[model samples]
Target: MNEDERNKNRMSNKVVNYVGFIDAPLNAKDLYPYNSKVGGSPVWMAQPPAKYSHIKCTECSGDMAFLMQLYAPLDHLPQFERSYYLFVCHKCNATRQGWKLIKSMERPRQGYNEYEEEEEEYDEDEEEEEEVQEKVVQNDTKNENGDDDDDWGVEDGDDWGLSGKTDNNNNNNNIDELLMKRDKMLKEEQAKKKEQKNNKQSTSTSSTSTTNTSSTETSPLEGFVTPSDPSNQYKECYVTIEEEVIKQQKMHGGGKGGKHGYVDDHSEMEEWSGESYEYVKDRAFSKFIKRINHYPEQVIRYGFGGEPLCMSQAGNQMFDVKTAYACKRCGKNKVFEFQVVSTIITQISHNKDVSSLDFSNLFALTCPNHCYDVGSDVHNDVIYVEELLLVEKSI
Candidate 1:
């Protein structure tokens, strides 16, 4: 027998030990009775129960003390294409992904026919055709596997399967690295585009300035009513400076738990009448409360209710308020009301061209909540706005 045949023979008779499977050897019909083809191949039974100690989980270093099976016929080389086993801890099957060994099966060698082997011309054509077909199949498999390389990278690492589990911190690190790599690549691409844009702008500017220098001096601002107009021989042109109008754009509040610089106080705005106006006011307050919950600051004071009330848009801060209330079991009735004191909204921008600037709007308010006991006097508590709602504006 040649090497291939020798390997096949050894595998057929081999009795390698494994971790999980049936122990007894059953006939093909017994194991897969309903299968169309039984062929005479033997099917092995599952192995008996066994204990695994110091079974360190691949992800965690904790010991596993579950009973599992010992599989037999570890090498499925001759008749079978691959071998498989289960290293499952009965309690935690979520961490267990079965192990599979994809070993190559021995191919049967064609016998040498002296008389037929004389047709070498025909054999060459057949061999070439087979080689071309195998090449095509290999190329197809490679193309399919190459798609979405990022996702497949996780499977390539050593500590992935149940036998070699990864810890939470290591997994987090891997994720962070992947994100950082992606961000770095994106930044590099953006920088390249920006550099190209700057180069183009510089080239355009040089060409325009060169052309202007070659021609007669002509003021580009000739059409505008400039302050330097020579025909200004009349009434003093008082500069009618327009008061800046701030148009606010919606902003999502920051995350929870941080130092907040502002508090929510809307007591002054409460004086507005009518049901329709009151509804709008309440809506605004609700939106403000939602925004505050997202702030990163830990020291934010909302109204007297423990609910998170407001958020500071600019920095590390959130404000929440907790009101003092009698227990629900108490018979006396109590009422709580909140009021706003002073209010201010401001917009500031650094850009010279009004249309091109990135500007922000801020809203500041001072509010107080008054609690009245059914038969007693009123008690007042103040919630101050320390953080400004620095919101970006358009136009």
Candidate 2:
């Protein structure tokens, strides 16, 4: 019948599950079974004319992960094939669902069918004649070898033992010749394989030399060249600014029982002014002077536990800061501390209309066991921006 009738018949015959596990990458043609898994490379079916190009998470401003897709074409609307896509953000509880309609092109004409043609029936007499001819040929070959029952007792000019010896020698000669031919063929094959291998190696060496020459000719700008030594390669440091501040506080007698020790109670803490302000500001600048020179001044925010806060949920409400995970290197959960680099504050205050009175706080979690060495290839720590507000503006 028509496409719709065919689809209905097929659907009635079997139920299709549109869900699949993602273990590897997938493409459009690979989705033919109506349902399949996708990993790494997912086909972006939406064309340029569609509303949105790609999906993004609203909460964390991160790219959304592709979960599943569906394709269905109706008979009446055969020209327009609709595709449904589902995306999810694991860090945040956000779901982005949408669909796109792609215009289907006309299908090409099919070739001829062979099933409609008729076949001739077999003839029993012709088959019997063929079988008799095969038997006659077999008998003639036996006669030439003198293996027939009628010629078994016949007396030749030579002795029967001599005749048997001659036949054995002929068989041995034929076997030797066959073995020699096989050896020759095997040697030729081996030689051909060796030549092919040499050719491949030469081509590969030439290609590698060409690539190296081109790279050298390009003469990449300074600071952009990748280090040839593995030890010099860039790696992430897991150390946080909070841990550094605590260490400095202890070193400068600002820890517990010391004259400049900070109180545990938030209500007892003094406002930023005079000596307190200068101490904090100096500590921040000294700690992050190197980093300030290397990297640009910008706010990088991250979340750890609980549902991620969207733009609406991120107002004045204070949320619990999630505990940082264990050191990925030593697997030890101990010695983890929080610290803040004050250089960022100083840099921002100087650039903006911010006064010393405008207070802001940013903290990072760090491991104490020298786990923050970038050269040793340690895992980077997860740090979050807790607060960034002007006291007067907030009030």
Candidate 3:
């Protein structure tokens, strides 16, 4: 559904809405790489990409900084832990290709499939087996050295007792040997049981680690580099998440607000305006202003599996799911994940010069299948998949 249909559905029913706000400037320890004014390293979900091509500026073909990453895991897609990343190339900010938005989700298993984690052979189990073997060898050596107090009860042959009791002595020796063998077998069985118990515990722990973080509890950006830049850095701040229902109702309810329902007036001709008087009457541009003006502070309009707050009237023809946004990995149509609004350009533009980054909005269309390669190690496969990022430039 389009934004109008989505809004109408919410009027009579309860719906959740999300908006991204730049909370504060990054201090020294925020862990995310928000300083890259241009595209920086992606804030990886399952595993950092083997190659850095995702964040490379299409114009410059270079790795740089000023990036924002959102750890917004979807409730519907619970099996997958999701993180959305936005990187703008301020150096090439004048062009539409100057920015790239990425969505990374890690199910640790197939998202839709039942998660039955594979049994694993932990390092500790093997080490315990080695220890048990070493102990058995040590006990055998001690018994051979006449250490009766240690393992077995086979005494020296010198104590055969009386000559008449030779047959009895031989039987006793055989019995002692049999007892020794039984004890060794019992010990080996016990060791095997212990190994099985340890392996069970290890597998259980690994199975529960289905999130982005591994069982080791490593830092979120463990293998990836923490990006930093001073001059060209896009402002990194905590995302102030708010609801549209509260703000929209408060401002417009009881006929308290403006007649246009808090929408912006686009009839005026500004000195900084890039379009002519005729261009101001464009249907696409008018609708774009109406939605954004309602929540002007929102840099992002987030509704997973929802239509984008469309900017251009002719943009939907380009966003054809059957042709343009189809999943190349799973041979299915890509679904709408989220969109980064044009207001985001104001935050990412370096030194307020966004000549190339001039776009109305970016719609992230991801695989409906949530496909990832299931490797040999089912318990620890990481996927870094890139989906379609649709850009709608001003008409």
Candidate 4:
């Protein structure tokens, strides 16, 4: 079999099947030894009073899907008590892990009664005495076995002098044969164990040698069509408008500072409301909007799943960008869908108080493969921004 097939076979042999409700919430019935939920709602930070927000995948710029929330509590250190939030973007082969420390309420202590303390001490003493008695009995049995050679003239046999069966010679021969067989079987078992150990040592040595040889070699081709000619493709493209073109184009009043500019009638403006609005309004998208608000000269519009002005876009065309890239490890392409365009960040830096920053548009992408193999550290290979547009506006 091939390397991948061999790996799969080994994994199958080692896998443990668990059947139950995944991502179940902790309740009174489920106390002690907490377990993290998988692929469900995230438990946000409560001590700092933070809201739930989707983290953008670095590779794809798409919103990371919620993977799990781990609840770890410490008795002595309350500050260390935290919930870990894990998210994944399968397309980019990446993971976003975050933690939130929560404050735990002090549990009420039971009354320390003198009588209860006495009873506990008494119970522990009784248990110790019983254990001592058991050890003594075991010692006595060992002594009897050890002294058997002197008493019966045989080292281990139970037939002490053949008391009533002195005349039955056939029975004695049969017992001797049985003892011999038992000893033979035990020796054979020991020999087999030693052989197995030697085999394992040899296998390990061979494997180590093979690994060292393979490490020096380059990685094999993944079979994906990566273009050889670097000059054929450009990383970025730009569009510059002249003063005459701006005057001829139709103007609209929607940008900051009541600026008049050409608006694409075919393009649509998406508005995030309800829970989504609350989640993103305070995060990166909020900062992006504020940056745009400071600039009054440029007008912008959002576009999805198309070429950046002139160059042709690569990859399979789905209904949306969400279902573009699937999981490379488990090969689960249909079950889980990725979050398409949850949030967008313009090239403008929100940290600066300047009038405007460079760039015309921004986009985020995500891994199409979601919730395939839980807890596996598969590659997060989501695609980030491919091409950047440099627009020079002429008034």
Candidate 5:
């Protein structure tokens, strides 16, 4: 069999168009510190957003548990260091994001890469963990008899996935040598020059968001403990994404697939189909099932700014986003970033009562403007912005 055939899982449906599918679920602590992961407490980017230090459930006024963290730094908003943190309230399930969607964004530290020095310490262990993670994903391709679940990643000859910021912490070698390598990678270029902006730009006074006044406190979770609530917590797993391959697909209306995927005059159809919004919802609900049937195990779809595989017709679609879901910090319109599928709850915990977290999909809309900036103490401060997120329930 060719390499593509070799890597194929038992499922026949092939993932194409460079979409990121999370794989190799492992304990969050086993992998690199800066990588994407599900469950467990968050690995804070800089300092924890103080206001969120104690998030009470909107449903029951109880504490929330950490659900997952996605390391999705946008290229468009490269100056800011970014990561998405999800939390869930255990007291009441199906609260539809009554828990929270917190986004940590701040300018890069003025000195060296924030994670480089720390990550280097665990180079040997991290490399070994990655090997184990790969093996776990491979084993998932088939049953004991080795049949079924066949096409999980790029088909044909291509077989690599581009994880947006998975490799942010450049590892190994002399400290100086590692930093030198970062300058060469296109992805890390923005991070390198981010902290060089010494001259402070005038702050926006028109619509200033004072909720996240910059703080320099060390992460609160470092030594603190919360009331023991086992049901709210979940097992940890590192999320590794593989690229979906480009392929040909005959489009409706006598159209053809693009270089990446099929396209059409889909300005409106892309958002929703059918005449009435309710009918559009029915069409979307049907598609959701059919789509998940092929790759039901996908915990997340990570393609910031790219289209989110819809789980509903009204999933944050029926709104003037600027007015309804403006960025709490920048006051700019939030755009679709990535999404967490309900399948994640299956992998989140086996012991915990995850019943309260019911949803078909959780669509995260983030501020593409990325207007948050580090305070004078860039080395010590952090900016945590509350982003927009919505959950789609079963139709």
Candidate 6:
């Protein structure tokens, strides 16, 4: 049938119910009599096709039984308040089931006449056996030779009777050997296929179970742990930045505050301008300062939270910043890391609403972990101007 016609026919005669418990028969013929997709699965389940249903005949209730079969959609099933069954009317063949209920009647086997009509012809050997025996007896009577030729028939190796018997035995033996070899090969192939299927099913089930169990008991953020101090005793490898500490050298004259504290006008909090515009004009210069002259800067590593923001006589309070990238749908976090280039005192701007001035620095950030075009935009308030130095070299 054409695709459209097949689909229409299916829609017209489909039958289905919300079956919680299906009592499938053990016999293959009775249970799996129809091919269908159950519960949205492609693999076949034991159920009737969404087509016809058998119903009881109205005329003969119990005796001389007849059945009404319908090829229609299930919408017409009668609803006795909540419960109902649908079937074709045997008398009218209409799409409905009422007093004449649809019975799941057994299919009856066909009689012998239904197979082939004509009888097989009788064998002619029985009718001709008496005449053949009389001829044999007459021929046995010797006319001229005294010796009986009947013994000669048995003695000769090429005797027709003996040859026929020997040929029949040999044919039977050859047939038996051929059948045995065929059966052995078929059994081996079937065994191999069954083993492969079982192994595949087992492997899939095991991997699924393992993955679910592991995900349930593990935490994703347990990978990184930071240390409390900056000693770096526990860390084997670390990246250190050039930091300048004020060294109060003796003036070689009378002084106070531990032989004269280093007095630099820029140290004053109010007089200090923003780090970016005042300090580092170019990223290359900043890198040169870090390498040649020690300058206070940020340092980061695996265990390090991030940049060291402040250090005081009492103690150092560092700000730990961590970024977590994740997929919106799966909630699985992605890994990412970045480096900062140079900072400059580009300019100072006043707050439009407050009429108060604040220093803002634009920082260049690049991701070292990922293979891509790196620089990204970043900004910071009045603080230290830090920049990263990187060069693109073919690897």
User: For candidate 1, lDDT tens digit of each residue in 58-122?
Assistant: 45543332111111111332322211111212223232221111111112222223223434535
Candidate 3: where are CA atoms >4 Å away?
1-16, 32-47, 53-55, 91-97, 107-232, 246-281, 320-324, 349-356, 375-381
Top candidate on lDDT is: 5
Query: lDDT values of the candidates?
Result: 0.28, 0.30, 0.53, 0.30, 0.54, 0.25
By TM-score, highest first, what's the ranking? Answer: 5, 3, 2, 4, 1, 6
For 1-395, candidate 4 gives per-residue lDDT tens digits of 13232223121111121111222233422212123333333433221111223355656665544433333222332322222333444344211221121112112112113335546756765675566456445534544454323221334444543343222353345345545654575567656756875796699668867878765432221111112311111111111111111122345567675656443221121222233533533433433343334322322211222222110111111223464433355454332111111111132122223222222221222122222233422222211111111221110
Among residues 3 or more apart in sequence or in different chains, the pairs in candidate 2 whose N, CA or C atoms overlap within 3 Å are: 241-339, 241-340, 242-338, 242-339, 242-340
Show where candidate 2 strays beyond 4 Å.
Answer: 1-62, 66-166, 212-395
TM-score of each: 0.19, 0.23, 0.52, 0.21, 0.56, 0.17
TM-score of 4: 0.21
Worst 10 residues of 1 by lDDT: 337-346
By the TM-score metric, which is better: model 4 or model 5? 5
Candidate 4 error regions (>4 Å):
1-66, 69-169, 210-395
Tens digits of per-residue lDDT for model 2, 219-306: 1111111112111111111111110012112225555755563322221112323345446444434333332333333222221111
Candidate with maximal TM-score: 5
- Comparing 2 with 5 on TM-score, the higher-scoring candidate is 5
- Model 6 lDDT-worst window of ten: 37-46
Instruction: Name the 10 consecutive residues with the lowest summed lDDT in model 5.
Output: 9-18
lDDT of 1: 0.28
Residue-level lDDT of model 6, residues 241-273, one tens digit each, is 211333443455465544564342212322323
